[model samples]
Target: MSAAILFDGPKDAPFTLVLAHGAGAPMDSPFMAAVAQGLGARGRRVARFEFPYMVERRASGRKKPPDRQPVLLECWRAIVAELGGGSGLVIGGKSMGGRMASLVADECGVRGLVCLGYPFHPPGKPEKLRTAHLETLRTPALIVQGERDSFGGRADVEGYALSPAIRFTWMTDGDHGFRPRKASGLTEADNLAAAIEAVDAFLAACGG
Candidate 1:
């Protein structure tokens, strides 16, 4: 059986959001918990799951690198299938997890995609982008990004040829996880609240 962590909201919630953890965090990290709670409060079911490597790390108490792309994709497939095959479901997550969701979203035919912070390219390596598949994405998507994130900031992503189906919402001066610097005069809580609202709107528009 596949191993995963799930957070259930109101039993009769119309839709469920299946969220994955980022590269370095567990399924119940603060960020994941916050988003899940925010969505749940708004009357949506939310679930969180870890990739295989993270699960191993949890059991063994040793840090491990994320699984390969193929493995990650396979894990996503398994989770999606286990979660009822995408009916009334919006699938996504933080950074790396969101990127992986984008890769398989169309194939899985989910109701919608919500990427908390998309890593368009590696930090300090803008030349190495990971957006080849996004250009032709068929799934309805919402990407909430920090304006100054090292991964794919506003300035950098403006130049990428993203799919029209994907909409980007920017958090003022926030970083990869939507935490802005003090100099920006914006609090982390403010940006996170904004991101949550944007995601809610996106999901509503998509009929989720």
Candidate 2:
């Protein structure tokens, strides 16, 4: 079964991009909303949904940690199945959400994967890498990461043996949330816009 989805853009759009929230936020977070709305405005259908834990938190008015990896991956699978088996779908999300999507992108046979601020590892714990599967991922992927993301800064991530199928678009001096440093003379909105543009181009390349 698929989680309830909040959708944007025309139903007849060529491809449906399904996005999940990060570990802490809901699907309607400011960041999620901006990206969804931005893509919607560009003529791509966008769908946003929450994981089971986040859904429960929404109903109970309480904070909750993210679900375990198995549960999160199951949710991605169900979402893809419910959306008609992912032939024309692009699956992705913010941070942990994106990571979960990446884990299942190939399994689901999605047309493409777009990871916004992918967590290469926990913040300040770079030794615990979470990219073994990524080394051989077959599905085309775009990882929009911050140049200085604490989870996996460019300097750190550049050395990883990720698959050639995976491409990256880096945000200037940005952190996990893609918010650049003020002194860097770049704004969060600027990075976000760039990210959106990259995703748009990626979708086009995927024949969306």
lDDT of each: 0.90, 0.93
Candidate 2 residue lDDT tens string, 66-184: 99999999989988888888897999999999999999998889999999999999888999999999999999999999999989999999999999999999999999999998999
Query: What TM value does model 1 have?
Result: 0.97
Instruction: Quote the positional error of residue 155 for candidate 2 in Å.
Output: 0.5
- Global lDDT of model 1: 0.90
Model 1 / residue 131 / CA error / Å: 0.7
What TM-score does candidate 2 get on C-alpha atoms? 0.98
Off-target runs (Cα >4 Å) in candidate 2 are none
Q: How far does residue 176 in candidate 1 sit from its true spot (Å)?
A: 0.4
Query: Per-residue alpha-carbon lDDT of model 1 for 35-121, expressed as tens digits?
Result: 889878887788899999999999999999999999999998988888789766789999999999999999999999999999999
TM-score of each: 0.97, 0.98
